[model samples]
Target: MAQVEITINSKNYRIACEDGQESRIASLAAMVDSHVKDLVEQIGQIGDTRLLVMASLLIADELVDLREIEREVSSEGGAAVPGDGEEKIVSALNAMAGRIESIADQLERA
Candidate 1:
C-alpha cells in the first residue's frame, strides 16, 4: 500500500491506495480538488462538507452524461464506441460519490 497526501479546498488529506495506484489516486484527487475549487468560486465557501457533497454530485452528473452518451452511441450502432476508459471513469465516479455520501452521513451524525 501507499499513502498520498492530497489537498482540496486548502485542506490536506492522507489517502491510502494500492502501491502502483498512487499516481492514479493523485490524478483523481487533483480532479476532485479542481471541482471543489470551482464550486467554491461559484458559491463561495459555504462549508467544506457541503462543498464536497456538491462537488461529488457535479462529478456524478458528468458520469451520468457519459453513460447516456455511451447508451446513445450503442443504440445508434456508431463506430465511435466508448472505450474501457469511460467505463473506468464511471466506476471511479460512482465509488467516489458513494464515499463522499458516506462521509457526509457520518459528519451529520457527529
Candidate 2:
C-alpha cells in the first residue's frame, strides 16, 4: 500500500491506496476539495465537520440526479441518445458517483 496525502478545506489527510493508484486518489481528493472550496466561498467558513457534510450532500445530490437521468434515458430507449459519447459519459459519471459514495461512507466512519 502507498500513502497519499490529500488536502481538503486546507486540512491534510493521509490515506492508503494501492501503489499505482496514488494519482487516482489524488484526483478524487481534488474533486472533494473543489466542492469544499465552492461551499466555503458561497457560505464562508463553517466548521470543518459541517463543511464536509455539506460537500458530501452536494456530491450525493449530483449522484442522485445522474442516476435519475440514466434511468430516464434507459427507459426511453438508449438508441434515442443525443450524441455519440452520451453513453460513455453517463457510465463514467455513474462510476464517479459510486466512488463519491464510497468516500462519503469512509468519512462517516471516521
Candidate 3:
C-alpha cells in the first residue's frame, strides 16, 4: 500500500491506497478538498466534521446525477461507453461515501 498525504478543510490526512494509485488518490482528494473549501466559503468554518459530511453529500449527489445520465444514455441506445472515467469516478465516490459514513459513525459513538 502507498500512503498519500491529502488535505481537506485545511486539515491533513494520510490515506493508504494501492501502490500505483497515489496520483489518482491525490486527484480524488483534491476534488474533495475543493468541495470542502467551497462549502466553508458558503457556510463558514462550521466544523471540520460537518464540512466533510456536506462535501461528501455534494459529491455523492454528483455521482447520482452521473448515474442517471448514464442510464438515460443507455436507455436511449447511445454508443457512449460510461466505463471510461465515469465508472472510476462513481467507484471513487462510493468509496469516499463509505469512508465518510464510517467517520460519522465513529463521531456519533464518541
All candidates: TM-score: 0.70, 0.71, 0.70
Using lDDT as the measure, which candidate wins? 2
Tell how far residue 27 is off in model 1, in angstroms.
Answer: 0.6
Q: Runs in model 3 with CA error above 4 Å?
A: 79-110
- Tell me the lDDT of model 3 at 86: 64
Can you tell me which runs of candidate 2 are displaced by over 4 Å? 79-110
Counted clashes in each candidate structure: 0, 0, 0
Q: Candidate 2 on 1-110: residue-level lDDT in tens?
A: 89999999999999999999999999999998998887676556778998888788878877776777677778878748567347656676777657656755655565
The digit string of per-residue lDDT tens for model 3 on 15-104 reads 999899999999999999998876666556778888888788878877776787667667768746646556656675686666656645
Q: Which pairs in model 2 have colliding backbones?
A: none
Error of 1 at 31 (Å): 0.8
How accurate locally, in lDDT, is each candidate? 0.75, 0.78, 0.75
Query: The CA-based lDDT of model 1 is what?
Result: 0.75
Q: Which of the numbered candidates is closest to the native, going by highest TM-score? A: 2
